[model samples]
Target: MNHRSLFRRLLLAAAAALPFALSVGDAAAQAALPSDRVLRVVPHADLRTLDPVAVSVTITRMHGLMIYETLFAWDSQLRPQPQMVESTTTSSDGLTWRFTLREGLRFHDGQPVTTRDVIASLRRWMARDVVGNHLGARVTALEATDARSFEMRLSRPHGFVTYALGSAVGQIPAIMRAEDAETDPSRPITTTIGSGPFRFNRDLWLSGQRVVYDRNPDYVPRREPADGLAGGRVVRVDRVEWQIMPDAATAAAALQTGEIDIWEQPALDLVPVLSRRRDIQVDRLNTISTQAMLRPNSLFPPFNDPRARLALAYATDQAEAMAGGWGDERWWRRCEAYFVCGAPFGTEAGAEGYARPNLDRARELLREAGYNGERIVFITSTDIAPIGRMAEVAAASLRRIGMNIDLQVNDWGTVITRQPRRDPPDQGGWNLFVTFASGPTMQHPLTNIGTNMACDGRNWSGWPCDEEAERLRNAVLDAPEGPERIRLLDALHRRLAETQPYRVLGQVDQPYARRSSVRGMLNAPVMVFWNIEKSAR
Candidate 1:
């Protein structure tokens, strides 16, 4: 057999061998299992690193969340809720944050969670390797005043610090005490201790395949009693089995065949089919942002010009792309901004400049630049199935506009290999590409802009007017969350919208398929499992 075929066989063999090592089927079938309801997630990417600091990918974030706890968590509506913290108060200057640690909380190991542990965990994540994806430097300092009182001082005011914790930068897996990890900054914590309802158990089959989490007998959220499953409080599942069957077809078949109990985030195409099944519960949700974006770096030419980017946007067929990516009629809600379009934030700003299928405009702009269909490279992840499908359709759409499109679909590993590196590396391994959330703080305001949109922005798209964008971003940050704050952000969104910093192509319509027993669906956009404990059968 050829090398490719041999590799495929080896992979399949390895996957088959994994279940046997842990006797997964037996463990899953045990009636005594806490998680009689296992949630099987079929996503485009696998959870690679469990070290929270190293984890920023969406897939890893979702899975990592079940085993870790952050300072704060979110409800479906995007409001901040306390998870590990009893209350978080910001100083008037907004430079320091004082958090009251939730009492009676214990990591899976039965060690009580203290302010020291919280500070230590954050410190580890603050190390250059972890938060580096968003922040340039770690926190200036972390001080635990007492056993349960802690204060963090940011180099500058970061109004949305909690949002960052809840998002991608939450703890990475490997259940050890944070104190230990913090002591050795260079050593990555493969295991960790967490105060979540679920405790990590090593008897599981595979690393990313089937991780089994048993109910933490010690898991008692101070505010919410664990007994009230109907109230939708802490974790209810006695055990949680995370089976990584990356293929949607396989996951669906497993659901139908009774091999799995639930699917965390199913393929967009299966929403209808699964929704129609009365035996299963299909929980649907409206998230904050779902649009697949194209990052044409304007820092360099062709892309640097707003007019050029707008022309490119006008040239492509967004509707067609979304349809293909989402599977026929199953795409996400379209959006025009990083915040949900039509959301409070979206309404104040974000109108016009999508360039939506105006072929004539695209032709006109291209002619203005020098008429030619030279090949432009587009980079994306194969693990991101939607983007993969979208890229294929996008290439076709651009081709019709006389743009010779060379789309490169690489592994998620390779796609992000050089992502953290300076763009234009090796003469820019890519040109135009699609990217997702820079982070909660990336919109404007230097603090925010640097999170996602800075030219040095981790997801930078080679835009030239980055300096100008940064200025607007800084202005928005200066404006807090008030009428004036809204106006400032609105103006920044409008500026970026006009510049096509990144097209807010659409917001993903997140759907969770579980047993009829589950509720608490409308949580925040990250799709974390913090509140799932209260959702009952």
Candidate 2:
């Protein structure tokens, strides 16, 4: 069968199995809650981890925002604004900073938020987050002066201190309780207590089926109007239910039937059908586009050699890959720049030769790298449509260039859990995978986790250790925000192109589908459930 026919058949099969997939208890619970008071959504993926600090997955980050509040948060303009902090002061030398917390902030457990929790949380976050590590390197001391205030003394002046604390990208710097924050950063914490506007109902949580959250009655919102991730987080719905439906057709059917109020990410093929419906509104909530990437394991063979990585880059076609993954020329664009295409630091300095696929050039590079048909294990997620399609495109390109690709398909949760393993590809480890990041996360050298080349294995999953790249990155960070900074960024970009830390496949805009009854939705980089109301159908 053709691709379209096969896809239609799969959707039909999935729609047929929807009844068996949903439990009777789940249906009964939906009946118990009033339609206007409950906001039912089909999330992008199954939430595998609860602790956002431990795993950098997008689902955990969304879950973290529901329960936890950051000291600072990015506004609609991408500028840092105080979220939990009442006031802030900095020393004349710019080395010492002090912050005070707003009163009436209490966790779900009914305990007051204090500076001890903030300090402990920052300490743990600094151990994992890329931006946190940069700030941690310059930290002289971080101490809690009183119950409501804390002080941070740095060795040198850092310009993006608040930005690091308020990052909404991968591995968010969410503040937790002192006891929970004190746990080891390498391990995931089971406790789910925070001071955000919503409270996670862990008791009613059914793995792979449903997750629920109730509005916090005692939680105090900001006085200002709601913006991006900043301003007041006013909760309108009594409860938010996350119905995990792996099949796109099933989720789309539910949304059309008013069984679900929102679908986080509907399959691209089904977008046109859903947009034609009067009750459903398909819109792009995030203003910025997301860049898709192909990350290779730099620690293992084949990919360990820069030539092999470059061969893959030369073989893959960005337009073809993006078309296969995103489906529709209007939503996707080819981006060769590592920092993102239209950003300030975005430059395709050394990416001239690898824009389009050159099979001869790729074969030449593979031969020069002494390749002997090594088994390249490419891991993908079937639950996430774009990722799965991107993997297929990449694998096809690699095979055409005479590479042995072993494509392994699994759920998103299993793929994320397996990405961290450092074993050989023949074992449980992976050789490559396709993923995407928000445009804001990839706009800066410091904020982009993929560019980090920390040799100590403390970096992102694919550990790429390059001392020169690290030096250039540090230079870019220290430089002033002007011509000098841009020059340094270009140098860093050139170096990254040579090393090939990760291949930039393309950029695409993803839209969320919500019913007409769902209102007060905010436009942000990531989805937030607050400030939303569900009208009775």
List the global CA lDDT of all models. Answer: 0.57, 0.88
- Please state every model's RMSD to the true fold in angstroms: 7.0, 2.5
Q: Pick the lDDT winner.
A: 2
TM-score of 2: 0.95
> For model 1, how does the per-residue alpha-carbon lDDT over 294-385 read when each residue is reduced to its tens digit?
66655544565667677766876667777767755544555556554545555425545552678888878877766476567777765667
TM-scores of the models, in the given order?
A: 0.75, 0.95
Error of 1 at 80 (Å): 2.4
Model 2: per-residue Cα lDDT at residue 102: 92
Report the error of model 2 at residue 116, Å. Answer: 1.4
Which candidate leads in TM-score?
A: 2
Q: lDDT score, residue 56, model 2?
A: 79
